[model samples]
Target: MGEWRDVFDIKRDSAPVEEIAARIDADSTVKGANLVILIMAIFIASVGLNMNSVAVIIGAMLISPLMGGIVATGYGMATYDMHFIKKSLVKLSFQVVFALLTAAVYFSLTPITTPSPEMLARTAPTAWDVIIALCGGIAGAIGNTRQEKSNVIPGVAIATALMPPLCTAGYGIAAHSFHFFGGALYLFFINCFFITFSSFLIFKILRVPVCGGVSEAHFRYQRWFLIVCGLVVTVPSLYMAYVTANENIRDSQVKSFISQDMDLEASSVVAYELDHGVLIVDVIGAPLDDQEIERLQASLHQYGQLRQTTLKVVQGPASQLNQEQVQEIINARLANELKNDSGKSYKELANQYYGSYKRDAADQNLLRSLNRQAPVLFPAVRQISGGTLSTLNGEEETEGRQWLAYIVVSRQLTADEAGRLQQWIQTQADMPVVVNIQLQDTPSQFYGNGIDWNP
Candidate 1:
């Protein structure tokens, strides 16, 4: 057993191409079995990534049909087997298409548009990935040559992880983002080229004999063909890597600047967005004074990349900061002006005078009453009785009068309709019973302001 293990181990590191070809040819059932496995694996992988299930995704990788395709690709290149090449290409293409369709269908049905961390992680392939593929392919080829293969095949599978790109491609199709397609396809090409080429090198190392009439001329022709293919695949990948690096560099610069210069804690930066020519920094924690703003501007100037800097300072959590607060403040000032000018409450002035109904129900009704105008339509609410009612008796007998706080919610009002509403509400009878006119904003549009409690 010890001698057999030693012999097997030696063969494992030698003559990879012949051994892999022999293995495939020896088992007549391999083609069908592999095809089925590949299909299942791709489908599972697509679903895993779409659902963002890491465990399922790894499982898919473990049993991926990618290795067969890669092996076929190597066989085709090393032995000049066009038939094998065509077969492998067809098999791989079918698997990828199926996987992509499956993933696309899943994503289309699901409601997740923003990419998960795993999805985003696979987008940008790097130079290191090429190195890993080269090494993995070498190990895989060496192991395949042996009678008793080690765990190298599994390691290669996990390392290369070809299913992810195809899965991402499906996500792109579903999300209607071709950028994802571009990135994913690039990754696929990277895997194909490096692994195939590495296998070619291994075959040559193992002294796999070449076809006789596949002459020097044909060989040279094939070499040029491969070189051209390599160039075609590599240029875009390089460009993507550069772009990713630049983005990383920009983020690092921004983070470093914030850490070094700002008086506030770096953790306080709730949302920081860097665009092509501008940096929009939103800090939500405490309100910033003018002096802090000046210092921030000065620090930003040192970076010298940004054409414009929009600094938004809010009090509370960054996520809690209502970006629309500035707009609301403007609207509030406008409401105050319209009310003052019209000699009415804000709601009345907007509804009756201007006929603007763009404001929400709460703002509109309140402004209307302030403008002394009656709303065109009154909203209905639950009637709760609580007040004392006078009973009809010569002795002045008293009974409890039902008291209910009436809630009147108005729809969105435009400026012109708001003015008219204000004016209209002003003409109604002022009864002290229980009438509450509430203007309610749409839930989607309502962003409450964050006030600083620390100060």
Candidate 2:
């Protein structure tokens, strides 16, 4: 019993009250250097979100100064320092506004408008996030009261993650996605509310002494307000967690049913789409007869999780499948695979993910440059759009990737107009590009990807 008490005790090595209070007050004050660090943290976090680089995001968290303010505010509450609490809250609010506006401006001007994995993760925080914030806040508070500082403070900053979500909210503002803004803002609020509340609990446990004094009525009032605020912040996260858990369970069941249970002959599953409890699986090779499809659908009951899920199997030859849809599925699969694999270096992984953004930017630039250059080079050309096409041998992409461009025009071009356009494309690519000229009546849409229609 004595050994257990010795091991479990926290007040044994606590710092002097004055020293601890002074430190918390210092950290809580938002000033010149801290403000600068906060702004820099926001940009770093925003870039990490833009690039989908987790390491960069972690680096940003390391430098973030928001934890100081949060912990200090909690200490203030524990000590009943209303004046200090007011000052800290005011400074913290200013920091948040500065960070959000800076992030919004950066995102608005940047070319990478697409949401990255880091960005998406913040936009849909659940109960798990709340738990993490609480644990992190508790750890941070305990660390701050210690006579010696430890890695726990920095680690807590990363775990609670105050900066990324704010920047994601800024991104939502820049992108005009109210859904993203609201969700991310809610996540930030969860972190802030829980962390501060946890710190208050820890400070009380450690028995942080009151500075001036406290009235009984004010203490009760503050306590009730905190309770109400906690409820308000926590309920939505619980609901989100429930929804997220169901989605994950449904996805797992659908995948299991597709891979293990649904038996098909002379066909392979190509892509899938799950929506509102409906599962749509696209397969290529051999077409299934209606009876076989019905059997597969009926077999969903075998998996308890998928019983409510509606399964529809679409079977057609590779030529009949939607090329754009299949390509998107492939890209998503590959990206997710690489993201979860711990085998790759973070730099290499970053490149792989960042390459997708670069490709999108490149595609848009090409379209703009080509369209602008079109009238001067080939007046007969109305507009140009281009994409990469994988040369397929059967259902497998065998040859390689090639740039496929489409030129939309109302009438046939003169020999000079046609010649210039072809030369420009080859010069730009440094490789032979397959060009497709469309008549006003019949514009070509990646018709049947397996066949090479290059003339």
Candidate 3:
């Protein structure tokens, strides 16, 4: 038990140059392992990023040789080992290159072009990243001081999270995504700087020896090197800090305005996105009533300058809505109704109630089966007697065997429009499938009157 605790403590301790150097040189095969592990790590990282697999990404991070380079660099700085510094830099650069090249090649070969959620996630860095890096660096330093490395390696792997950003960079290369490149590279740089600098601090604090006798010239050289490294790291940190501050300000303003103007009686205003300095709001149903519009405008005007506030409103009909949006609206309304007794979300409720059309997969299969068995030409030669199949309850019944299926369209459709639709459906086939048409009555009513709910 004592031995286990000590080993754990060693894994959680920080290190000096001598200790780190001994560890690096102890394993005769470490250098060779470094090369293989790094390449594999980078490839895994890229795949994980592309697929948005968090577990795969973490596994890649665990296998990455990145921490060794940073550790070596810090050790070099502390002990003034120029050879170690060069070796570490070369190894780190190779790892990075391998990762990037691997990503580029993999993505080029893989047929999937769509960005996975993981890929999208790594496309941005936030202040929280800085916090994570800082904490990780501190923990890494502690782990280094320990003799047992059970926790150190895992801690370093988790804290560094090196694979994600590198993989992100690879995604950029593969997908021609400049945004991915910039964001990912920036994140990688952040990790590199923090890890190396933190290690440097930990070493200096532990009073790691400089190997040779202290000379004024050597001391001055070391001081200058430290200063240069500090400058290099600080530049990006400061820029990231500024960006984080700006994002926070914009987010605060948006939330403040939305919260302050909750009294607006306008049609439900759904927040879509702020793009090109415009807010895209989904206004379900018809345009808001005059009173509702006035209330909305009045409330908005009080919160911010209304001159540049371009709000793109989208109006939709209940009949046009598919099941997903209808259900979403229903859920939103239900939540609102549960909170407020006025039932302001009743319009959404109504939309959901009317829009809930149960689509049957089996029906689609049946249509496909019928279409295959009885190849009918659209614009089926219609006669006055009984030439077309009727759709009375939103279901089409037909045993079409001709070039096209003759459909009895609803009377709501004009002859010209019906002919055009038949022509359109016919075009999908190689041979002309003429649709023979007839007029029939449908129970469903067209709904496009007015806004019914307040969001």
What TM-score does model 1 achieve against the real structure? 0.61
Instruction: Return whichever of 1 and 2 wins on lDDT.
Output: 2
- CA lDDT scores, all candidates in order: 0.61, 0.79, 0.60
303-368, model 1: which lDDT tens digit per residue? 644325554443455455453653343356445434323212223322432322232333445444
Question: Per-residue lDDT for 60-149 in model 2, tens only?
Answer: 999999888877778888889888888888878888888889999999999988777678778888999999999999999888889999
Highest TM-score against the true fold, candidate: 2
RMSD score of candidate 3 (Å): 12.6
- Lowest-sum lDDT 10-residue window in model 1: 380-389
Error of 3 at 112 (Å): 1.7
Could you list the CA RMSD of all candidates, in the order they appear?
Answer: 16.6, 9.9, 12.6
Top-lDDT structure, candidate number: 2
- How high is the lDDT of residue 68 in model 3? 70
lDDT tens digits, residue span 321-361, model 3: 66567556555655554333223334443544552233233
User: Taking the candidates one at a time, how many backbone clashes does each contain?
Assistant: 58, 0, 29
